[model samples]
Target: MNDTPGWASPGSAPSDGQDATVPRPSEPADSGGASSKWSAAQPPAGQWSPPSGPDGTPAPAPGPAAGWGGPSHTGGPGHNGPHHGWGAPPAAKPGVIPLRPLGIGEILDGAVSTLRAHWRAVLSVTLVVAVVSQIGDILVQRYLLPAPVEVDPNASPSEALDQAADSAKASLVALAPSLAITLIGTLFTTAILTVVISRSVLGRPVTLSDAWREARPRLPQLLGLTLLLPLISVAITMVGIGPGLLIGSAGGVALTFLGGTAAVVVAIWLMIRFSLASPALMLERQGVIASMRRSAKLVHNAWWRVFGVQAITLLLTFLVSLVIGIPFGIIAMAVDGDGLGGLLSGSSPEFGWPYLIISGIGAVIASAITYPISAGVTALLYVDQRIRREALDLELARAAGVPGYGSDRPGHGPTGG
Candidate 1:
């Protein structure tokens, strides 16, 4: 489904083993597909073609699936191209994606495998972040936050509503500490894990120390970019409904609703547009604005594809979090319900410290596992976009020191690198 012209149709790949390396004559291009960064950057002579033999005959396409089209659609060495229905090759996985664009399943599986293979290092980073965040949250919930103030039963309805609003405001102010810490933690963890996942693609070991050292320099920019995104979204939302709020009438209310709906749609568009900025920043060593611009460029005309993949990854992580967190939530409710006086008063639903700690355990476990998956998917999406647009697989192979990729001669391989 990749749209590089002059590239052979991976769809028409042969079922036979040997000649699967040969690029069949070009078929009609898949115009509906997103144009790749690779194809856009390429010179006319640079698109991959069958290698000429020593005697000037065409040689086999070489060195695994060569195009960012991602594996082959027919049988070939180290590939099951024909059996795959989606034109996705099943080869070069289990933390394998750097050498090509990715299948959706491969991206998910690669994330899982990276976590599985480097559990110690990955867990160390995430455990520290998660624990710190959870502890801050518990402290805020307990000592700093007031128990919800009870509404006066005998008062007017308006008085009760005002009391409830005051209680909500106090709780939010108390929550500021935890939320602030969590935001910082997420930025650092994303930076470190992006390093770990990139190295993992090359089959390299990354210690927590190694990840930290590499990730440290870029932290400021990453933090800025991360914070900037939400600010931008909020600013747009406010600007959208600002005029309506000033009017204070029926027309204003209608205008506010319409403006808010439009704002939501714009916010979603911007979120998808900039989703790859983290990876571009971390892996490419790009500055905040540059990375965001890079992300926007890669995501051009591919918003839905990026959104779908991100949505699925998020759903998977959420389900996993629920699986671990639900039991702990139940236990916390059961144990803390009887002991807390607030239960009878109904001022707050937050359980005592016992509940906070217990439930926090589930939160810790879930965050530790899912953080890598989210980070990996984002990083891989950046890689996939590059493979599509910049022929990044060839460069990746060269970086990984893959055999034959170093030579650009006709006999060297399918990448023609």
Candidate 2:
């Protein structure tokens, strides 16, 4: 790995901290039905030996190694056959997560573990971003956004329809500024947190300064990726609903509904496919397009799995936000002197500074807690996918200074006589 916390593309040369003498093996070709896809220099089953020394002898065990797959792992000692004893050894866990394919629960736990273990750095990064985002939101709400559109229940049908249209437009207008602020905030937070989580995986310590220094160079590419995804989704949506919208008739409305649903399905599939792009960009030093392509490749065989984990994360975060926000929301209403009457009557309350400030606090707290989990899952998912597909745990072990994995640093490795 690089000092800045990155890995080389799969099947490529080792990165900065990896030993150059230990070359990575090329991956098998995908689904070509030709035996040539398999490497010709094959060891017989259960006869694979670990890397040998200069004398062509199997290197001695590197003194009491730990973790799954033994100390010198190339898919563990059991790679070629089933375990014959008390089962496989536990995977090496130098950091927040085990250095192997991760379970969903493990992925979620790993994110939370990083936050707990490095609360200061994680919270510092998140709190700052959330506070700034909320401040912009409060300012926008207070002075810039238009008041909610008032529709009279007694208005004629045509008048009511007009009011509804006006309301929709107003809602979009109000949402625009806040969403923009959120996008910018997420960009910064994701970049920084990725570095933090990556370090944590190696069981290494990191500070906010370290994370920022590592992440700063990649911010532009991250931003471009962030902006591009939404635009792509929007373009897909417009393409789906455009014709129906143009017709402006009841039939057109039905067509729009059908088209929009299909478009949403496609958009969602694409989003899940590209979900790992941000981390790929941040960690691989990849460009915007390259990172996206990398993500698509990683997600290729695991679309539903990725979608399921992401959905669970989304649901959990939403629940957490609601739990944290509701009390603050109620208090804000009480403090703002609006009471619950508006809520009971299905009407919007006019919020004052007290309400905005109090609610903003809730938003900040919720965001501070949720950001790490969200970003961590994405980064770890990227790691997990690579581990599954490319046998990246070996590289991670080397980078983490695990014995018997072979180290690049002089004093870190066992010296051969």
Best by TM-score: 2
Kindly provide the TM-score of model 2 when superposed on the true structure, using C-alpha atoms.
Answer: 0.81
Cα lDDT listed for each candidate? 0.71, 0.81
Cα lDDT tens digits, model 1, 1-417, are 111111222222232223434433355455557564455665577687776999999987765355544433232223312233355544443235536567788788878888887888888999999998888887777787665566687976556646755775777687667767877878988998888887777666778888888888889999999899988987898888877766756577678789989998999899999999998787767789988887887787678989999999999999999999999888877778753556667655556777888899999999999998998898887767655544445444544545544443353333332
lDDT of 2 at 122: 92
Cα displacement (Å) at residue 131, model 1: 0.3
Clashing pairs in 2: 68-90, 68-91
Single out the weakest 10-residue window by summed lDDT for candidate 1.
Answer: 1-10
Q: Estimate each model's TM-score.
A: 0.71, 0.81
